[model samples]
Target: MNKTLQTDLLEIESLLELVKKQGIEYLNKIDERKTSANVHKAELINLDSKGLGARNTLQLFNETFEPTIVSSSGPRFWGYVIGGSTPASIMGDWLATIYDQNPQAINGEGDISANIELETIQLILDLFNLPKSFVGGFVTGATMSNFTCLAVARQWFGKNYGKDFAKEGITEKINVLTATPHSSALKSLALLGIGSNNIIKVNTIEGNREAISIDDLESKIKTLNGQPFILISSAGTVNTVDFDNFNAIKKLKKKYNFWWHTDAAFGGFAACSDTYNHFVKDWGHSDSITIDCHKWLNVPYESAVFLIKEEHSSLQVESFQNSNAPYLGNPMENFNYLNFLPENSRRLKALPAWFSLRAYGKEGYKNIVENAIDLAKYFGSKIKESENFKLLAPVRLNNIVFNISNNRNKENIDSFLTQLNKTGKVFMTPTLYNDQKGIRVSFVNWRTTKNDIELVFKEMNRIINIIE
Candidate 1:
């Protein structure tokens, strides 16, 4: 080994201790940390043949780059549906890196990490009150999860027409129907070689709502003339957190020949709360479902899962099978994750979720989901009461879509959001709802509380004054 490598190996314990202390300090003072970082241009450093040891490199990183790290994981960050990490999740994430196990096959030649992943998937299914008939696997995030599900949907569509799109190219136009899909889902279509513009728009429910209109959806299906299509439905929309009527969709599935996919993502957490679970009733009936562990399970980044019916296992294998590589063995016989999902090799991405599920069972998640919903309602109430702000939509679950009350102030929405984010006390993202400029404040973080809402309210008022 190199001299620096040898030294790092010798002082591994002390190095880990230093890192532990830093982590503790950050988590302890997360609330006080700035939600946004000041713009600073980093100076480029050239590599040298003589290397700095681990300790020296750590010091250099702290001095040059650490200050630029923003507290997006903090409670006041209400941007882009992000969530903070739980203690157990962080512990599991750390161990995942230390172990560095590549989870692939359950009973293969390597470690049993895939078995652990399968167990974690079962725990997730139970938490969501889903049936055991769905087989799930971890992916990078909701985008990849959507990609995996839709890829199989594509193959299934081809199979309906006596064609193999995976073996050959897309032989026919695949009809995809959706209302208010997340941008990530559309991006998945683009990545899957299915044109994003090809989606047939199903009208949303009448009056300020994002949910799909069942009548309009059925009408669109009628136009397809008994053709097999894919229906992409939203369980939780980004701006307003509106859920499509899953019960009605389930009814349509009996009559229409189409694959149902629900992008529940963070919204799937509604299953945890009795008060909110009604929003996603009968969601388990979806042919495939996408949920993000990082968004609501309080895990670290790059974690999401796609649950597809076990009956479609052959279609999934046909969609993602690595047939060229003989070493990988038969995709159908072994039942490996490599043939089931997009990626061939993935880390123990399920470990953090396993740790989180074990650490906090159904009751704990219920409390978390309920607390977030309550906080969103509280914040929405404040927005409604404010003279300067007005809600774009009712607080559906855990997202508040609001805008400046005065129509004349519409042009200032972007500037106001910029200044608000610059305050460093809170962060939110801007949106366009019903062709009007708006801002979205999502409450998915477990650490968010009534106190955080109060702090944000005061900060928003202060920023409003400065902007006005």
Candidate 2:
């Protein structure tokens, strides 16, 4: 080994201690950290023949790059429905890195990481009040989760016509119906060769709602003329947190033949509360569902799962199986995650979620979900009462979508959000809703409280005065 490598091995315990101390300090002071970073270009350093040891490299990194790190994982980061890591989740994440296990096969080659992954999936299903009839696996994020489910849906759509789209290429255009799909789902369609432009956009509810119109969806299906199609529905829309009527969609399943897929993502957490459970009622009837652990589950990034009905297990394997890789064993006989999901060699991403669920059981999650919803309502009410802001939509679930009441110019709302973010106290995302420029404040972080909302609201008023 190189001298530097030998030194690092000898000092591994001390190096880890230093890292743990830094991590603890960062976590302890996260709330005080800037919500947004003042990013600037850093000078590039050329590599030398002689290497710097890990400790020196750590110091160099702290001096050069650590200053601009933002607190997106901290409370008051009400943007894009992001969630912070729980203490238990952080522990599991550290172990996952240290173990360096690739969760692939459950009963093959003495690898049990995939079994742990399966157990984690079961825990998630129980958390969501879902049935065991659905088989699930962890993926990178909501984007990849959406991709995996939709890939299976695509295979099912093809199988309906007695065609195998996976073995052979997509031989024909597939009919996909949806309303207000998350952009990630559309990107998945593009990746799967389903052609995002080819989707039939169903109209949302008639007034002030993003939920799909059941009548319009039925009309679109009629155009298919009894052909098999895929209906990509939403459990909770990102902007307004609007939920499609899963009950109505479930009713339609009796009369129509289509693959039902709901991208629940964060909104699925509503099931944790009695008050908000109605938003996702009947969602379990869907053929597939995507939920993000990194969102309301409060796990770290790069963790999400896709739950597809067990009846479609064959199709899922067919959609993602690697047929020619002999070493992976029989795709059907051995039952590996690599055969069921998009990734072939993924880390034990399920560990954090497993740790989270085990640490805080059903009741604990109920508190987290309820608290988030209540804070969102509190913030939304503040926005409604303020003369400076107009609620663009109802304070549905854990998001508040609104517009600046007085500022008519489109650029002004964007400027207001930018300034508010510059304050480093809070961060929000801007959007265009129904042709009107709007801002969205999502409250999914478990640490966020009423006080945080009040702080952000006061900051917003200050910025409003400056912009006006």
Candidate 3:
């Protein structure tokens, strides 16, 4: 054996000793960083440090690595509609990385991966009461999810209208109708040859579309004058926690033959709760839906779900979608996952979502969703009781859109947000609801306790009192 290659017993023992000691210590060091509150900030380290040994890397990790592991997992992180990750999900994520399963397309890896993805998709379909035949795929987050769904919509429309959007591209005359609160991803969809300027911004009631009166939708559709239409609705809007009038919009979809897409990135999963199911009820009929498992499901970063009303919607978009090389695509030809998504190689992030759903069961998910909704209501009620605060809209789903004061202008409104963020007692975001600036809070974390909301109010009162 070569001198360096043939492991001498002494050298092997030394290597093992280094690995065991350093590995154990490094893991403990990471764990400490995760469980601590000092993670509101972090430092960086040089990857190419000559002086750093294994001990030094561990030391550097200790000195630098700070976890963004949000208190969302803890009882006080009431910032966004983010879910605290479950232990089972974390373990599944680890296994996925170790195995490094890349199920971006269909036929790259083990059946277990694709099947896990299919099964997860099935569960979501069942959860949403969608058709069993609907096709679904795992994506990064809502943005990609929205892009995937809208891309399918574009493909479907282009195919139906005899336009080669996949090759010759959009006719430069296609139009998409959406609301003001439509997620920013819509802008990206517009960039995907859908034409941002072509989008017709409908007036919405409240922050969501549940209040979108049928009259407004009818009037808007009537004005279209035979233009191609792709109607986008929200299952749960980010601001105002409003769900677009899906029931009302469904009627227009059938009448106008428009591809109805729902961007329920954060809110779509809320259907897990019976109380909130009405928000996304009848979603089955929608041509496409975009959902995020990482938000309410608490899986991990970049776990997005895209569902299509018909099978092979992904395949239809295949003109622009990825196709595997003969060497890679031909052998394991049972199913090639790459055909569906824009990416060829992607992390098997679905495993964690599958594992999480299996571990939690439907009831477990329902309970968690219910808990978050209830907490939001509880917080909304608390805010309502305070004279210093104002309720901007009805507490619907899990978002509380309210203003700290009745001051309704551009200058004071901007000042209020800056003050609140600077205080850092609570991190809140502002939105435009009914053409007015409203502060919104999302109760997404399972760790968020009732006491946390109380803390938020106390802090808000302190800040408002000082500023007022």
Number of the top TM-score candidate: 1
| Order of models, best TM-score first | 1, 2, 3
Question: In model 1, what is the error at residue 379, expressed in angstroms?
Answer: 0.4
Q: Itemize residue pairs with steric clashes in candidate 3.
A: 105-337, 105-338, 106-336, 106-337, 106-338, 107-335, 107-336, 107-337, 208-242
Candidate 1 lDDT score at position 221: 98
TM-score of 2: 0.97
List model 2 lDDT by residue over 1-468, tens digit each: 899999999999999999999999999999899998877686786887888999998998898888888888999888888899999999999999999999988884677689898899889888888999999999899999999999999899888879999889799889999999999999999999998787999999988999899999999999888998999999899888889999999999999999999999999999998888899999999999999889999999999999999888888888887887532434456777877887788889999999999999999899999999889888889888988888999988988889988654545888888899999999889888899889988888889877788788888888888886
By the lDDT metric, which is better: model 1 or model 2? Answer: 1
lDDT of 3: 0.68
RMSD in order of candidates: 1.5, 1.7, 5.1
- Give model 1's clash tally: 0
By TM-score, the better pick of 1 and 3 is 1
- The residue-by-residue lDDT of candidate 1 on 238-342, one tens digit each, is 888899999999999999999999999989999999988999899999999999999988899989999999989888888887888433434446667878988
Each model's C-alpha lDDT? Answer: 0.91, 0.89, 0.68
Cα deviation at 191, candidate 2, in Å, is: 0.5
Model 2, residue 258: C-alpha shift (Å): 0.7
TM-score, each model?
0.97, 0.97, 0.83
